[model samples]
Target: MTPHMNTRRAAALAAVAAMVVVGVQTGTANARPAAPDDGSSASPRTSSPAFSSASARTAAIKSAQTDASSTAGSLGLGGKEKLIARDVIKDAKGTVHTRYERTYAGLPVIGGDLVTHIASNGKLKGVTKATDARISVPSTTAKIKTAAAARKVIWAGSGKPVLAFESVKTGVQKDGTPSRRHIITDATTGKTLHSYEAVETAGVGNSQYSGKVDLSTTASGSGFELTDGDRGGHKTYDLNQGESGTGDLVTDDDNTWGDGTGNDRQTAAVDAHYGAAKTWDFYKTALGRDGIAGDGKAAYSRVHYGDAYVNAFWDDSCFCMTYGDGADNKSALTGLDVAGHEMSHGLTASTANLDYVGESGGLNEATSDIFGTAVEFFADNATDVGDYLIGEKIDINGDGSPLRYMDQPSKDGGSADYWDSSVGDLDVHYSSGVANHFFYLLAEGSGAKTINGVDYDSPTSDGSTVTGIGRDKAIQIWYKALSEYMTSSTDYAAARTATEKAATDLYGADSAELKAVDAAWSGVNVK
Candidate 1:
């Protein structure tokens, strides 16, 4: 799995941002009308007890905001600090998590966001802040144009090409990179105020799994380099059991590659390359996204990472994907869905930039899983048909079981089938079950079903059968919500709003698609 930050850095950040909420009093179930059991409810009954009353929730949020503002000084906030409540997640247990944005001296502080966990008795249990530094900037002057700065970033090729403005607290990022170095650019001057790494690196050659695939090769003096001149000059490298260098650029005189077996090292490369190409096509053709960043640029892939390495990851630092040969170096972990899942991490980073922790982190993982499944379906390969199971081809569990089941995520020991207050406590991978289940219910509805020879029996939280809006509509709604409506701090409640908004935008306010979106969230207990 691709972690949002390096393991050590992430742990350090977590320590700084940790919050604890103790003594939660469980509340009684507050139910409304239920969806029709005929699997054709035009408008389903809302199942979110916490958010059922809009006015009450809004009042609670206002109270939480006032409480947060009153304790600003105690929380280490400056005099001019303002807290804007972004979301309020309340559990049936009466515990509340209030997410907020901080503004200092009337300017938004990029990393000054925090979450306040309140006990059922209205006692402030703890607070989690991304950064505790005071917000202060020397100046907002710029000597470089925004376009030029972005161009410089692209030319440097150290990371993806994107720019923003943020005040520097310390002089370095968690990774020890220089921070707050870019000058602020005026709209007329085309200068931006801040810069962050946008590219994420992590992938296949004529893939062993995808059979023959189109390769973008450049002619070298000796023969040909495994570089795709067409797809933003993307390339694939063999790590050769070594941990670091970009290995060698695969080359061939005849341009015929791989023998579909691990004995021939190039077979894994073929799978990876083909997977990358197909993933690119999935985004472009299905969702109108140009590339991982929607910038028409390509990312590179590294295979044969370590001895018997059983995992793959997308590293934003190098803007590349890395894969390990599983078990005895026989499983290359570069299947179509695997490639799509890894690459979608880059997309999630560039787009929603969902915080890789708690519920948002689960959404991030589920986003990758959703797109991975979509990519598999888009390919329509005879060898590997699309299914709702994640990592079905990788055999990561060593027992022939898939890593996750979207239809009923609880089928896996770790995943949760429905949303709950404690869902956020689980690992992001397991917490992702809520969103995956929601997507499955949205696309295929509730009940026993079979898709591409795979059987699925999805149940609803309130025993209400749901009628699907079809996978095509479901994907469209999810993609629009992810790319346009969702933000870095979006959680399950906000996700419900985003998907509803997306469906309304794409299929009209009174359309069945919108109804389906609402029903799907309700089915997952998100409401």
Candidate 2:
């Protein structure tokens, strides 16, 4: 819940008997991964009529790119502007939604990404633009030098576009995470145009898995390393209570990983490694995604992040997830849901790249919660049954209460159960309650219900009876919207449209699934 940026240089760990220590901070590292080919890619669930194979998905993207190249003018693009395809998704009905990044006069337009929605009949439905501002600059050259700009950068906000200088700042945040602050400033007047910290922080899960867990590790020189060669080479490391740099990789002699207790550092590593693998499997089997970036590479994890740190975060700079010991220094924050939640942040970053503020920020958080819950359910471990509660296993509040409740978020005293004009003004964590509530309602409907021994009593804003559409269907709809219709600046209203469109694409327009989606949103006052 705390926000601070930590500076991280590209650092490596040296292998030791039981650990690898982080040594030396050198080389430059970007705050985030380079723009992925499609930001994210996933085949539709088998039930949906979408393309099921990667080759087919790539072919669809190529076709969409060809169409975008030929129809740029019709899409209201300037003569000098070129559209680069980011992702292309097709619905069960053959409706295509293509996301594109824009470059004007060969310069990247910071907020100029868009999604073009086309119906199965080849009719243009609409286009969602990150910024509605017109893109036109007198010059692409910067009048001010990069050094003179200090800390500002970017082009095209709400008004006309302008050339800007990119200023970079790298250092460690107070919380020990890496920080890469990028500033975009106006080239002509030297005024600040836009700025954002590449590092995002938050707090998660594991010292809570059931008895005897299985971990996938690789053989080292004479021992086994906590590296998952089967799933994109994900490695688990121990920070040794240090706050900075890549810590030592956890190594074992006989390949047996962890005890159920945290006395052994590899115990937390077991939970983290297992959680990462389950989350990976959830995305691959349930959503057809390869990894966090939808690419075949894995992001590593760090345990014992700081002394009693009590938080876990996904840092884009390191392309990894890190966890802290709880307030007691014994409770590892690495729960199953926590791992899914943190990793989902990387998924959001890779795809929509939603600005982590206001309504979009709320959606971003909700996206993680939704998928995190899905991952838990997918894992379906008897020790950790899936539920709509976030942070239930971690015991973050010291009491047995969860961090947030989806069925009725107000129980948290801070989260909003329904949408309102002022919801956007609230912290993103609380605003996320709106979407979380909607998701719960859509998945389980209103009124009292019990699943996996967890009871939920969700209410409706309009007092209308809402029927459940099942979590599988609900998750599919949300995933479709996020990867296809939603953009960086999409808010509650836009989210409604995106999900409705997604439902229409997956199920028929008049199908019960779409109706449930509408009712659920209305239940949350998103309408």
Candidate 3:
């Protein structure tokens, strides 16, 4: 078949797994939704699992937090609310938006300041009146003495806290991006932050942030502390600018850049760039693995795909990654989690090579869900804090509900909480729900727990028996099985055998690790 015909047929077969094909315009506004197809896996996976079986469905699993209840969401969020704040900036057709968010009431709501400027040459001609000229945070708010201190709020705060508008530097570069460098010093404390808007809105070839230089509290007053600027340049914005109380102060080097011109591929590159680095860092530091395949090779990513390719993905053929700019927002399929998910597929491919067809498919699907969640927790982006929710940024359903729920995968129609013989016949994404739920059960256990104010009470079909092994250990065992034991065509029964062996390798055959793995899988009604 032709490439297009192959894609159609593959997508159809992938429907056995709910793979996301993202072939439309997916940007800030006017982007298309994931076209109607098989409900598929709870989300996309790197590739299919080895073999699917009714036996894998019998294998069991384990399972978090709200806007105000991030790490632990069991409490009433301590009054912390959910904020779905978004900023829309349109230069006639294209928009430059910066998202700021916070929680209010119980449900996640949207609120924040996005300054749409009518400038000529990096000089601010005007903003949409919402630009606060004063720092919106309180003086009593803890002053950031270190990047980590500031990062706490960055991951959860609405946006930057602009103390005051210092000066808008202007000039002209031969290119048409932007001819400006924004340098500002907080009047209250005299900390400095600089912003550079590229002159070419179409797409800057490839500039990166070097390092984060602390320009705050220095006697020189203009001294900078670069963090890591070897490949890319960097920018910052204070987070206390617009919020009910204290927020983050930060800036972007080229936040308002990257038009969907043919050259917009750089967008995906940046996504992959940051994503692969962070994922590598997290695995190396947290899990002690080298790369996706347990080797220290650079995983790749592809961005600015076809016209408005609405989805981001990872394929076995190309060891790298890929992303798409939504028709409406450039941040559509290219969110951090999407990048991580695509990359996780590579990890799965090199490790398990699970078939994308049946219950093994669900195991394959959940494999991505589990690691993608871990990746978000790893990067810890200030604005997009890690949560167990999938596709929380990309509003594929637009119902405000994220695409998939780890604690409960069935939140989106067609997902199963427990595996059965018929699961493989369902869409992979949907069918995979059973395994995703099993993974959650293994990690977090079964119960109606509240995370970030979102209430999730997982139920068991065969409630007569169940146990919780916890997420961290579960991840270790799964990764070990995938990397050291599994092959491309291993079936569901083999998954149970490999995982059981993994638990034993780490925790001794008679230890709790093996027992827990067995119990967790059993809790999910797998065996």
Candidate 4:
């Protein structure tokens, strides 16, 4: 739970020359991103220069790989450890931020990820590590079997390395969402090391709120199916009040779909489909991400999830998005921002994989809110104009109020407007308010204002005035932090560091963006 296992930094690095070959849970369809089919490491080639352009992604990754290989020993990496490049980003000034996953003795080191920052001249600037501990385990043999370890209660990590066994349990939660919980235990002691839920639940469109929108559908048998051919063949499904399994592919004789009312079953599907397209476009157009997983593969969507379910979620297990009908099945949860929120969960899962509890959990949720609001603004649809309010259209609170207020999160009553010593103890939904408030202050400044006809008065915990940096730069800094600098265990403190580094990389060491990032976090009491 502590940021990056720093307490274990003093652990001696074990001699790994004669390390035993161990079977590690490296990838699963439900928990991790897809890997190569040939069981080879996906490390980027290190023989290229990273030019300063969008097409230089491969070169940037390669540059990072080269740096990682050279700096392993200095970073306390064992001889048997190898770094697998997860992502790489190059700033306009040619600074490179490389994200990597570690394997020791060919075993995946859980929570052993780091981001390395390199100057354009190839000098290593610094490294942000998820754990400062060096890998040192006596043996790779497991004394306790997976079945027995599953019954034991979870224990906290001491930042020490141990050969661990991963047990994946798949089932359904009480809320009818699929669960893919990964349980890790000490291989030798049979004590539970850690357990985390992999399902990142949380979107979409419509003819409902968004009047007369266009859709991307594939031609079917004398009809059109809710399949987007342009964006990785993305499709939308109608769950038809069922809690499990994909119900059916929503189709129409013509491409036209849904009325403003939710009376037609296709109405909800239309909204979901439209929202998915817009969200996809937002990521691609604004952030350069191809899709939810950034592999140019689209995660599908499910609408009308259950009878009056009143919610929405993103399931990494199915690589899909699900939405429910609100009260009386009259309101669908498929707003543009809602769709963006659900899919961003998948984006987070595929990238940072932020832990879904404590301060890290709050960060995970706030990430969705930030990107969800960005998507809404990016779309700029007339009917559902972009605003700082979350879920204003769906009305989850039974009042005409939003589920969250970014400018003043405390307006929702349950959310925190600022961080404190015990902010992590709050529910993630409310603790997220800290970051939400920070984002609002960063994007719109700390003061009274009106945007898109909605009034807001954002306050600062330190009573200091903050100037706006505009949402465009604010979002870029966040996405960089989330994708290249953050890890599974990042908290608010680590988050501030990550964003500062991100800002420096994006705008330079002394840029206004960097200063604004600091002031905004201070306004939220994160510093």
Candidate 5:
């Protein structure tokens, strides 16, 4: 099997457009972070006007150190309480409690008591005035017209990270689209490079990405085909399939392509197209970066990677994204959160570039899941509504439970929301709890609350109250911490170090941001 074909029943092929999945077989390996272990994309962005306030630098530091020494560890914590208060801090915006007591990337709820209290160094600003905050559920679900009149209108002069290109003379299909034999143009130079023949499987046409092509069809011969000029011309490519899967041949480059929508391939296509577009927009607009790599780098994703693959991942060598349809017993693994999570692997690769082996690996995975949830909120799709719940739409386990939960990571089968010294050694899914809990406590505060009819009880190490600053502020602090302060081998303690630094840097030690950070960590039992 190719590097992309790790131990799944089928593998994907994106010759020009992600097409179909060819059935195969394989061995299982330890679950690892699906990000490329290359190119330090995690380095902080160019620090535009985004990173100003050098004047308050020293004051913030001294205040942060004093708050760290005074507020944390004063509360004796264990279990859920410890998890809730993991790394709380305060800042000018008020106390921004870490959201997850043990979960990562959970929704944020902001509002708390004690706006400003005198720290050893001085009084922190932006402290919460009340301890109660509610979820800001958005009521907007307006759909926009995305289908363009012309193919080029949707794809021409688009922005994505494409390093190099060459042209080939390919052919046009009966559908009036370019085939493999049609002439290709270089994206950068607008020059013709070469001519080639289309791989004949009958009706495969060209797409904007894969060019005109039909990799396969239903027994009835009506299904989805590639659109020319897809994601700057790329698709999942599989080399073999069905009874055709063999020993020497199976291990060969027999990659095909398939969509994740079990019922209709077109549905999957629409979702993928929309999901990618929304994700790209979120990062570009909210964070002010080019793309995943902050350099306009574009990556291709292949759904239905292997038969019943049941998982999604990213690989470094290929710089590709892959997902599975499902087993007869299971459902497709492609949900908005799943898509967001997988893409986050790409983001993690470019920044902090955390190791994907053990504890750090768990942090890496949680980061993807965390950011993935946030991206869902950013999209606000109706069919795929935004919530703290992950995999709400994709019933992968058939239990009505999502793949992971930000408010309570443990609600899922194999997630941990709190951090013990040993948590970093657990599965990445579980290890993610530390950060998850941190975010939860930071955004929502500690104690009992009801959201969307779901019952939750956020606890803190000290009996004192933590406040919520919402997910928006929490995410920014975490992003800054990850990109600026975190390094490989960082465990729960290290995360505290990083996030505290971030809170102080972004808001100020004496700012409400720092106080919230301190309280949030305390709620997660991080103290």
Candidate 6:
């Protein structure tokens, strides 16, 4: 599976637009502090001009709306085209960034959202959109009933339930699935306007991270299949050494599977099954989420994808997770955290739906990392003790170095330790450092520390000391913010606002949780 896909590309453009939008919105085009060259300091200062009166806020909002409207027109949108402002940020200097949802002819376009960047002097810089395609439908009438369309969707997936109906212009394909095609059934005609795979499936498998684990299996007429009767009927398939085909399901006579060694291919299947179960339990038990999609449905897993594929991914198209045998097939990418990381992608899609670009894109990747780390801690497996380092067991780097370091994200040599205007230019994985560092600070604070026998040293941008709010509280705040407050266009500043609101909702408005949320963002140079 390719880590850098269309999702990342789309997000990159969005990030660039968001950065421009943020610079203008916060009126911080001039006041925004630059990140340290060495990535050692988090001392980026943001000037907050007080808007004490309601009239001031109203004026700011109106100014942003006007700017967005003008920019929309410049982008060739007609007077009938509506740009509904979703979010507006006005910095102390009067610069504005307006996030908008576009409507063409009274119909909502899926990828028509954009961020408008306006300078304090009202100069239009540019606009960023998910897609530039013109949105138009032949007719609004549908020849199919909602129930019948829903039935057709279920039939397409062979039983996967319908999620929702979305309006989309361009049907982008991913992983051989029509990811953006929505089953839009016309109310008047009941006809299927456009149909695509709504259920996204990515493949994932198991490895040696959790050691031996108990698996749920069903007894078929011939023998026991790899399907799990419990846990949403999740099943594991063997891909053998091929890269494409979904291999046969492992079957056994006695219902017992795997010998705890690679000699038995089913051994990896056992690990994959166990890891999926554990991840499900973690989400449900800790966060009150039922499953990856919070729909009480289970996603399948594919093991041994390709010969030494060295990667795993959660593909929304297939609505499943796929894993590969790392390096010479001796190592499988199916660690507990890996499982959690891949599965969390599904959760992110269902929840925040954070576009994989800029700061929002970084947050998208970090969400998976955060949950992956949480899952590791949740499992408390002795063989794979929880640590802030990501992808430690699989040895992807070939030098035994972890893929990322939460304590000091820059330690990986590519990730940013603090947020900078240029951070959006980096790959989503590397840009994710800012949020990973923020999470570490929120959970473990700044300075040197040791966790699960691993050494770590985290620093702040402004050099202000931070006291931890504990991982449990930190995760709760982040999750609540992601699920409730965050949107597809959320950037660093918006994230700060979201977390503050989450903390207020969880604790009182005047609670320390809110304070910690602020301090943690500051530590990561988000402010």
Best by lDDT: 2
Residue range 376-468, candidate 4, lDDT tens digits: 888889998999998787777777888888999988887899999798888667888899898888888999988899999999998999997
- TM-score of each predicted structure versus truth: 0.63, 0.65, 0.53, 0.65, 0.56, 0.62
RMSD of each: 15.9, 16.5, 22.2, 17.4, 21.2, 14.8
**TM-score-superior candidate, 2 or 3:** 2
Worst 10 residues of 5 by lDDT: 16-25
The Cα local distance difference test for each model comes to 0.69, 0.73, 0.48, 0.72, 0.48, 0.67
- The global Cα lDDT (0 to 1) of model 5 is 0.48
Q: Which scores higher on lDDT, 1 or 4?
A: 4
Instruction: Please give, for residues 1-527, the per-residue lDDT of candidate 6 as tens digits.
Output: 22323554443432111110111011111121121111112221111222456686677667667766666778787665677777665533344656788765565654567777677787876666656655444443444445433322111122221222334433434323334444554444454444544333322233366765566765443345677655767888888876455678876665567776666687778777877888888877767665776545688888877666666766654567667676678677777777888788778777777877778878888888899899999888888889998888777777887878899988888899999899987867778889999999988899998888998888999998888878877887888888878987788889899988888877778977688889989999898
Writing each residue's lDDT as its tens digit, candidate 2 over 131-195 gives 88778777766676668535333477657777777787787654455667777778888887666
Q: For residues 271-371, could you state the per-residue lDDT of candidate 1 as single tens digits?
A: 77777878888887777565786545688888887788666766554566667787789888888888888888778777787776788878988888899
Q: Which of candidates 3 and 6 is the stronger one according to TM-score? A: 6
Error of 5 at 461 (Å): 4.6
Residue 229 of candidate 3: its Cα lDDT? 32
User: What's the CA error at residue 422 for candidate 5, in Å?
Assistant: 1.9
CA lDDT for candidate 6? 0.67
Model 3: per-residue Cα lDDT over 97-167, one tens digit each = 22233433322221222222323243334333232332233432334343331211211112445332334
TM-score of 2: 0.65
lDDT of 2 at 239: 88
Better of 3 and 6 by lDDT: 6
- The predicted structure with the larger lDDT, 5 or 6, is 6
